[model samples]
Target chain A: MPLSSRPVSRRTTLAAAPLLALAGCRWGPAEDGDEPAAEPSNAVPDEQQVKAALQAIADADAFVKDVSADHVGLAEPLAALTALHTAHQALIAKEGDTGTTVRMGTPTRATAALKAVRRRELGLQRTLTKLAGEVSSGELARTLAAMAAGVAQQVALLPETAKDADA
Target chain B: MTGTDALQTTLAAEHAAVWIYGVLGGQTSQSSQPALYDAVTTAYVTHRSRRDQLVRWVRDADEVPVAAEVAYELPNAARTPAELKAIGLQVEQRCAAAYADLVGRTTEDERAWGVNALVESAVRQLDFDGDPTDLPGIDA
Candidate 1:
C-alpha cells in the first residue's frame, strides 16, 4: 500500500474531536437531532448592566451634590447630554452589534432603548442640575420627579431596549 | 441596555450629584458663613472630583461626554451648613440607590464597577447622613 493510503490513527481521530469542539460551541442537547438548543426568552435584564448605568449617573450626581450651597453656577445639561452620547456609544453599539451568541444576545434592544434613554437622561441630568442650582421653593422637588422620572422611564423601558437589542 | 446601559444611567445620577453639590457650594460661598462655607466647599470639592472622574470614565469609553457649564443658579438661599449637608445627604442617598439599582440588575463583567459604585455612593451617603453603619467601609 502506498504511504499516502496509511491507516487511520487513533491519536489523530481523538485530537480532531477536541479541536472541532474548541472551534464551535454547541447549544441545546446533543440528542436533539444534532441541532443546537434554542435560547429562552426574557431572562431578566442583568443587574450589572443597570448598576453600571446608575453608577455613571451617580458620578454625575456627585458633581452637583454640593453645587446648590456653593454660590457657583452653570447651565450645561445639553453639554452633559452630548458627552453621554459620546461616552457610552460603544457599549450602546456593541451590546447589539455582535451577531447572536449566548450572553451577548441578552442586551439586544434594551441597549438601544437605553441609548435613547441615556441621551434623554443626559438632558434630564442637565435640566435637573440646572434646576438644582435654581432650587429655591419646593418647586424644584415637584419638577425634579418629572425629570428624574423621564430618565427612569427611559430606564424603565429597558425591556424594550433589550428586545430590539436582541432582535 | 447592557452593562454600558446601566453605566449610562449613572451619567444622569452623577449629573444630579454635581448639580446638588454645585448648588450648595455656591449658595454657601455667597453667604460666606464660615462653618457652612467650609462644609459646602468640602462637599463641592468632593463632588467636583467625582464629576471629573465620571467625565474621565465617559471619555475613557470613547464617548462624547458633556462638559460642565460656566455656572448654575441657586434655587433657594442655602444659608446654613445643615441645609447644605441635608442636600448632600439626600442626593447621595438617591445616587446610592441608583447605583444599587444597577447592582441588582446586571451581571458578569459589569457587576464589579456597579458594586464599587454602590459602595462609593453608600459611603458618601453615610458621610452626609452621619451614620457610619449605613454602609460598608465605615467603622462602629
Candidate 2:
C-alpha cells in the first residue's frame, strides 16, 4: 500500500486538533539549552539484536545444510527453509557477518534429522520474536517480527510426523 | 508519526478489513465450502475484535476514533471460492502493511501490539494460499 493511503495523514490536512490533542503530554518542542535524551540501559542495542538474529539464521542454515547432505531425499523439502534463511540473511546481515560457514552434525536417521530441523526452526522463530520486542529500533523490530511469522508459515506446512504430534 | 496516529491508521485498516471479511463470509457457503467459510468467519471475528480494540486505544489517547465507512468496495465481485480467497488475501496483505507501519511508528506496549498484529496477518495470508515470504509486510 502507498504511504499516502495512511488515514491519519490525510485527516491531518482536513482537521488537526483531535489528532494533535492525542499527542497531549508526549508532544513538545525542545528548549534551547536541553540535552539530548539518554539511551535506555534496559533496551537491547540494535546492533546486538541484529548480530544475534544473524547468528541464529546462520546456525539454522548450517543445520539444514548438514541434514540435507546426509539425507539427499530431504533436500526438496528443506529447500524452502534454505531459501527463507538466505533471504532473511540478505535483509538483516551486515557486510562481514553474512558469511557464516559453521557446520552442524546431522542425526543418523532421516526422520530424526527432520525432527531436529523442526525443533531448531521453532527455536529460531522464538528467538526472532523475542528479539523483535527487545530491539531499540522500531523498524528492526517490525522486520524481526515478520521474520518470525515467516518461520511460522513454514512450520505450518511441514509434513506431520509422529514426533511432531507430540511437539 | 506519533503512536496515536499509527493507531488511527491501523484502526482505519481494521474497519475496512472487518467490512471486507463480512462480505467474504456471506459470499462463501458452509456446505459447499466449509473450510473457506470457517476461514472467512474467523477472519471477520478477528478483524472485528481488532477494530474494537483500536477504537478503545484511540479513545484512551483522547482522540475521536475514525468511524467505519458505511460500506467498502470489494476488489472484485467475489462470486467464486477462488475469488473470495483472493479478496481474503488482499484484505490480510493490506492489514499486514498497516500493522507494519504501526510497528515502526510506535513504542513500548503499542509497538508490541503492532508486532503481534503483523505476525497474525502474515500467518492469515497463508490460509488464502500466499507463499511464505521473506518479509511479510515490507513491499520488497
Candidate 3:
C-alpha cells in the first residue's frame, strides 16, 4: 500500500520532523558568522523509505500467496522468497511502524509471477540503497544494506535461473 | 566508519576467506566428497577474485589495501567435510557483515561493488548449508 493509505501516527510525523528540517536546510543559505548546525545525534529514520519497504513486503506476501495457490512446483522457491520479504518487513516494522495495509495485486502465471517478484526485488534493492544513504544511524543503514543484498540474491534465484539450476 | 575504513575491513575479510578456503580444500577429501570439494574450489577462486578486486579498488582510491595475515587461526581443524562446510559458512557470513557495512559507507561505484559483494556472500550462505536470513549481517 502507498504511504497515503497507511495511517501514520501523529507521533511518527513529529518524530520525523527533524529530517524534514534537514531537507529544507538544503535549500537555504548560511547566515553570516554562524557555523553550520551540527547534525542531530539521534535523527529520525527516513519515513517514506520505511513506508515503501513495508509496502514491498506486503506486496511480496500477497503475490507469493497467489502464485503458490496455482503452482505446486514453484512453491519451494516462492517460500524462500517470501521468507526474505517477511523478515525484511519484521525488521522495518520493529524500527518504526506505520501499520501495514495489504493492497493485493492481480497474480500472473507461474513464470510471470516469478518475473514480477524479481522486478519487485530489484526495486527494493534500489530503494534500500537509497534509504541507506539517507539514514543517519550506522546500524540502521547497515541493516538496510543487508536487506538490499538479500533482495539481490532473491532476484538471482528467479524462475528462469531455477530451471537453469536444474538443467 | 569512513568509506576507506570500511573498504579496508572488507579487504581483510576477503583475505581471510581466501586463506580459509585454501586450508579447507587442502584438508578435505576430494575423492570421497566430490561435490563439497568442487564447491570449495569454486569458493576459493571467487574469494581470490574478490580479494584482487578489493586491492584494485583501494589502490584506485589512493588508499593502502589491508594485507592478508601470514596466517589466521582456524575455528577448528575442520577434519571432516561437514566441518569444512561450517568454516566456509562462517567466513561467508563475516564477509556479508563487512560488505554490508561497506555498502552503507561508500557511494556510487564503490557502493555498487559492496552491494554485489554482500549479495554474493548471502548466496554463498546457501551453498554452505545456511538458511536464507532476513538480515544476513545483522544480529537482529
The single-chain TM-score for chain B of candidate 1 is 0.61
Residue lDDT tens for model 3, A65-159: 65666666677777887777766666666444545445445344556656666776677778777776666554456667778767766676566
Better of 2 and 3 by DockQ: 2
Error of 1 at A144 (Å): 29
Q: What is the interface RMSD of each candidate, in Å?
A: 19.6, 9.5, 11.6
Task: Evaluate candidate 1 and give its CAPRI docking class based on DockQ.
Answer: incorrect
CAPRI category for model 3? incorrect
- Recovered native contacts, candidate 2: 0.42
Q: Which consecutive 10 residues in model 3 chain A have the weakest lDDT in total? A: A20-29
DockQ of 1: 0.02
C-alpha TM-scores of all predictions: 0.35, 0.80, 0.69
RMSD score of candidate 3 (Å)? 9.7
| lDDT at A57, model 3 | 62
Report, for every candidate in turn, its global Cα lDDT versus the true structure.
0.39, 0.73, 0.67
Candidate 2 differs from the real structure by a C-alpha RMSD in angstroms, to one decimal, of 12.3
User: Model 3's DockQ?
Assistant: 0.15
Q: Whole-model lDDT for model 2 versus the true structure?
A: 0.73
Give the TM-score (0 to 1) of chain B in model 2: 0.96
Candidate 1 per-residue lDDT, tens place, B1-68, comes to: 33344455555556666776767766665445675566556656765665576567667777766544
Off by over 4 Å in 2: A1-45, A98-105, A161-167
